[model samples]
Structures are given as C-alpha cells and as structure tokens.
Target: MARNPERRTALVDAAIEVLADEGARGLTFRAVDARAGVPVGTSSNYFANRDDLFMQAAARITVRMTPDPAKVEEAMRPTPSRELVADLMRWLVQRMEDDRTGYLAMLELRLEATRRPALRNRLTQPVRANFDESARFHQEAGLPGDADAFLVLYLAMTGLLLEHFTLPGVLIGPENDLQAEATLNRLVGTVVTRVIPPS
Candidate 1:
C-alpha cells in the first residue's frame, strides 16, 4: 500500500532483524519501527497487517540470500563437476554465515509457517521455485548429479544450517570436530558423484 520502494525495503529489512532476534511473536510494527528507527506507525503504514509484514520479510530473505550475478557467472564459468558443486555448496554456507540474521529470519519464517496455513502456502511458492530452479540449473549446467542429488543436499544443508545457527555447539565449538567447511565438503562429495574427465 505504501509505495515508497526504498522505505519499504528498509522497513522489511528491519522486520527481518526483528523476526530473527525476537521470533514471530516479537515481530510487531512497533518493534520494526524501533529497529528501523523510523516513526512508530511507519511500519503499519507500509504493511497492510502483521501477516503482510511476515510475507514481506519472507520474500526479502530470498532476495538477500540470492548470490551476486557476477559471482554466479564466475562460478558457472568453470566446467560443471562434483568438485565445482562442492565449491558452490561451500559458497552457500559462507553466504548464510555472512548473513546470519537473514538466514535466522528465514528459519523463524519456517517455524511461523507451521502454525499459519496461509503463510505456509505463501512461502511454499518461492521455496519450491528455488528448489526447482537449483535442480534445473544443475541439470542445465551439466553438473555431476541428478535432481535427487540436489534434493538430498538441500535437505542435508537445511539440517546443517539449522544446527549451525540454532545450536552451534552441536557441530561447532572446541567440543565438536565436525566443522562446517569439512562437513559440507563431505556432504557434497557423498551426495554428488564425481565426474571423471575423458583421458
């Protein structure tokens, strides 16, 4: 409803932080306004309701998590191989690590979706599209795996991210030897068959 693109983006970004830090329950227009340092009613003006704000935050997380086009081009320039796939998986983990709040917000959205069917349906489109797009890209690029590989890795990575963020001690820290990079490489290697170049 509020048509200012920049302001809207800012408000949604702030909402993302609130969602991550405070969870869905803590996500209020007042919370968003305080996080954004805007007027108290600014978020209410921008969003139709809390559900609208949640949907917007969900959408924004996708945009924030998308890789840079230049980086994508660079990654794509290499011949598609299991090794390349591992590299890309590592890149994904790195991106999530770098944007921890964004990823955490996404996790919060996933939790919220379980309770709200409408929100679940709204979030499914992009999530499914992303999964399909990743599988399509892998096949189109001649990557050394089928759609199943992507699906398995997707599930594995989802678990990995969940543990890495919500319970870091589970996979990280001095007590644990299962580090993120090594664990991801192993996951990709196990899931994606190695492509042998012709002699």
Candidate 2:
C-alpha cells in the first residue's frame, strides 16, 4: 500500500500536539495514532520508529516557534536598525509568551538530540542558519563583523526570552509592556557597546 502524505502530515501534527501537551517523555506511537485519529499501524507505517516521529515533530515545532525571516524583513524594512532590533526583541518575547508549550517541546527535543547523533545532524542546519542570519543582520546594521559577539548577543536575547517565559512573575512587573521595553533598550545598548568602538 502506498503511503498517504496527508496522513503522514496529520501524524506529525498529532505528534507535536502530544509532545506539547504531555511532554517528550509521554510521546508514543499509540498516543500519536490516537491523537491523529488513525489506526495503530498508521503511525508506525509512516514513522517506522520513535526517533523518526520525534525528529519530524521537533521540526514542526521549531518551525512554529520562530517567525518567517521574509515577513520579519518586510515588517522592519522601513524601520531604523535600532528600532528594528527592538521590534524583533519584542516579537521574540511575544513568541515565548504565546507558545510556551512549543518552546518546551523544542527544548526537550534539543536535550534528546544531545544523545542522538542523527537528530543532532538533522537540527544542525537550521540552528546554524538562525545564528548565521543573526550575524549577517548585525553586520548589515553596521555592527562589528565579529561572529563571537553576534553569537553572544543572540544567546543573551534568547536567554532573556526564555527566563521571562519560564519565570514570568519573577522578573517582569505588573506593567509587562513597560518592563519588556526597558529590557530591550538595555539589551540593545549592551550590544551596541560591544559591537561598536568609540568614535
């Protein structure tokens, strides 16, 4: 029997939902099949193994967690570089706040990839691409073309977003918008100091 692409996609989507709702430890072929409303053998036919299903689910979640670069570029096209960074920072915070489940699932997958070489290779390209884009954007914005500094800024921004989401009430005040704006301003100022030398 031929495989159904629609069913395969449905299974992958179901796997993502299962991971998000129940965490990576709760994922199973049976669970995915049930969530997908397909026969028990259906997920097995498509995925062949747990690792296969997990990689697909992780890819789907990763895609959902980040904004499309094209759309981001278009939205910031008319904005100044500093303003664009601030907007991107705001967007990152919003994504963290809106999709905590998806982010958690991604983190779970990342941890698993540490022990699974195949999964690590599968994720390496996308991870590298994200870092590369950050570096290129900083360079284009007249920052020093230091890859290390760009990576530090990227990691710092991501860390802040994660911390805010995982511990929302701790760092953020009653006025979250104001707090986020202040945080972004400070982050951008630090990046500027590191990326630019005194004139």
Candidate 3:
C-alpha cells in the first residue's frame, strides 16, 4: 500500500518483531508503531490491515529462516547422502535455537492460519510450494528416497523442533541427551535408512 520502500520495509520489519514478541493477538498497528519506535500510525500507513501485516511477516519469516543457498550447495554437492540430510537438519536445529523468537512467531502464525480461511489459503500455497521445491531439490540431486521422503522428514523434524525448543523438558527426558545435534542426526538418519527408499 505504501510506496515509500524504506518506510514500508521498516514497518514490515517492525511487524515481524511484534509478531515474534507479542504473538498475533498482540500485533496491532499501535503495538507495531511502538515496537518500531516510529510515529503512532506508521504501521497503519504501510499495511492495510492486521492480516496484511501477518502475510508480510510470514513472508519475511521464510526469508529470515531459510539457510543460505551457497552453504547448502556446498554441503549437498559432495553427496546427496543421508549424511547431507543430517547436516541440513543440524543446520535447521541450530537456526531454531539462534532465532528462537522468529521460529516461535512462525509457530504462532501457523496456528493463526488454521482459524482464518483467508489466511489459511494464503499460507497454504507457499507451504506447498516449499514442500514441492524441496522435493525437487532432493530428487534432482539424486538423493536417496523419493520426493515424499523429504516431506516426511520435514514433518518429523518439525515435530522434534517444536517440542524440543518450545516445550523443552517434554522431549528431553530420562534417556535423552542434551545435544540437539544428536537428536537431529538420529531423526534424519532414520528417515534416510529405514523410512525412505534407497534407490
């Protein structure tokens, strides 16, 4: 809505911060203005509504959370082996810890999508595209396992990440060790070995 790119970027970035710190319910134009330390109606000028802000924030999350492609290419080029997948999972887990608030807000955005039809539809397309793109990457790289395998790994690791980071002790109990890398190794290895096709 706003043509001023710098101001718009500032508002969107501020919206992301608000979403992360305050959750969706707490993300108001006023809240965003205060968080951005701008004028009282700065966010209102940039975004049409809260859902518009939500969409922009969600889009920003994808960009912020994705691993660097150069690093990924370097990592995966050596081999499309299970070890590569494990390394990727490790990267994801490390990112989750490093950007704790960002991932937490992502989870919040996901929940919000479920209740709102427009939001759900808006979010679902990108989610599917990400899945498809990952599948293609794994398949094209001649990785062990089919396209669906990556999808399953995504689901599995998502669950692990959610519980491990958000609920902490709920996942790390008696027999579990404190190292997330170990858990990611196990999860990725299992998917490649036992779950996904080797051919």
Model 1 lDDT on a 0 to 1 scale: 0.83
Give one clash count per candidate, in the order shown.
0, 0, 0
Instruction: Give candidate 2 regions above 4 Å deviation.
Output: 96-98, 141-146, 173-199
Q: What is the TM-score of each candidate against the true structure?
A: 0.88, 0.76, 0.86
Decreasing lDDT order of the candidates: 1, 3, 2
Residue 163 local lDDT, model 3: 82
Tally clashing residue pairs in candidate 1: 0
Per-residue CA lDDT of model 3 for 6-124, tens digit only, reads 77777777877777777889989999899889989878878889888888888877777777888777877665676666666777788878878778888888889988778888778
**Higher-scoring candidate on lDDT, 1 or 3:** 1
Alpha-carbon RMSD, each predicted model: 3.0, 3.7, 2.6
Compared with the true structure, model 3 gives a TM-score of: 0.86
Best model number under TM-score: 1
Number of the predicted model whose lDDT against the real structure is largest = 1
Residues 142-165, model 2: lDDT tens digits: 544366755666777767666665
In model 3, what lDDT does residue 171 have? 54
Give per-residue lDDT, candidate 1, residue 32.
99
**197 in model 2: Cα distance from truth in Å?**
8.7
